[model samples]
Target: MIDSHIHADTRPYEDFEMMAISGIEKAITCAHDPLPMKSAVVTLEHISRLQKLDVKRAQENGIDLYVAAGIHPRAIPTDYEKVINKLPSILNNPKVVAIGEIGLEKGSKEELKIFKEQIKLADKLKVPVIIHTPRKNKEKVIDTILSLLSENLDESLAVIDHIDDKVVDKVVDRECMLGLTIQPGKLTIDKAITILEEYGVDKFMLNSDMSSAPSDPLSVPKTVHKMRLKDFNDSEIAKVSYKNAEKFFKL
Candidate 1:
């Protein structure tokens, strides 16, 4: 199984071991807001760690890890353009899969600007993107994200992540993939299954979005177990558990 989204840099090495043991064969670690992102230099260092240190850690623990580097909205620095300028070179790394975990947080002008810039970069590079939607005003934020995506990005090249029932309908027919983040304070396993049943598994993927927040690295495998018990066919299970992500990220 491929956990479509997570912050492996913030997780312990042991978590990767647990993930491997639980049947996660691969995972994608996305760039996120490391609070108090003071400068472009700090953000660059964070991206470096995701590409270098975290990738090695996951490999050592028996997981094939890929990376998505970008300026997260909450981590937007004053000199964010500097980071954008350097992303082309950084994304050239073979293990880098997408430009992601990037999108509206507070939905400020500055946030939208940075989000658009990264989307443009991803589109220009012809790479997939992992888009984030915030918890507060989720519907509004998702609508804004959808609008931006419709106007600026090829919907097929983006995955609108952290989708719950509230906004799932909005993204379902957008010609993009949807990420159901199974974690505490997020979509529970049962809800995820329901979404899959209703929407079909073709354009959806499962992820933990694990970070410092209460999370489970074993989420994807656990969901797979539950899906099997619920009598979902192997093809349906495979689509959400791994195939969608593999095809989207070209992994």
Candidate 2:
């Protein structure tokens, strides 16, 4: 299975082994802003860590690691243009899959500006994107993101992530895919199954969003087990746990 979204850079090295043991064969580690950004260099350094260190670490532990490199909305720095200029080359790394973990936080003009720039960059490069929706005012923030996606992005290449029931209906009809992150403060397994049943499995994928916060590295596999216990079919389970991510990320 592919853990569709994670931050292996912030996790201990052992978590990779545990995830592999839990049946995760591949994972996508996205760029995260752990602290306030000082410069574009810091963002580049973070992406480099995912590209080199995290990939090596995950591989050593028996999981194939892919990267999504971009400036996360909360991590956009003053010289963000510098990072933007370097992104095409950074994304050229074979391990990099999407331009991601980018979207609205406070919905500030600056945040929107950075978000738009990255969206355009992804579009220009013909790569996929992983968009983030904030914890507070998610309704408002998702609406704004949907507006930008409709105007600037190919629905097939966009992933609106960290969805809950509150906002799932808003995104279901769109052609873009959805991400259900099974992390603390996100959807529980029961809730995720509810969404899957309601929305069907065609466009939904499982993710852990694993990072410094309390998270289960085995979330995707655990959710797969839960699905098996229920009435879900093998085809349905495969779509959410593996095939959807494989087709979406082209990994």
List the RMSD of every prediction in angstroms.
Answer: 0.7, 0.7
Off-target runs (Cα >4 Å) in candidate 1 are none
Clashing residue pairs in candidate 2 are none
User: Which residue segments of model 2 deviate by more than 4 Å?
Assistant: none
lDDT of 2 by residue, 215-241 (tens): 989889989999999889999999999
- In model 2, the worst 10-residue window by lDDT is 29-38
Residue 247 C-alpha lDDT in model 2: 98
Model 1 superposed RMSD (Cα): 0.7
Task: Estimate, for each residue in 56-104, the C-alpha lDDT of model 1 and write its tens digit.
Answer: 9999999999999998988988899999999899888999989988999
Write out the backbone clash pairs for model 1: none
lDDT of 1: 0.91
Which residue window of length 10 is worst by lDDT in model 1? 33-42
lDDT of each: 0.91, 0.92
Q: After superposition, how far is residue 154 of candidate 2 from its true place, in Å?
A: 0.9
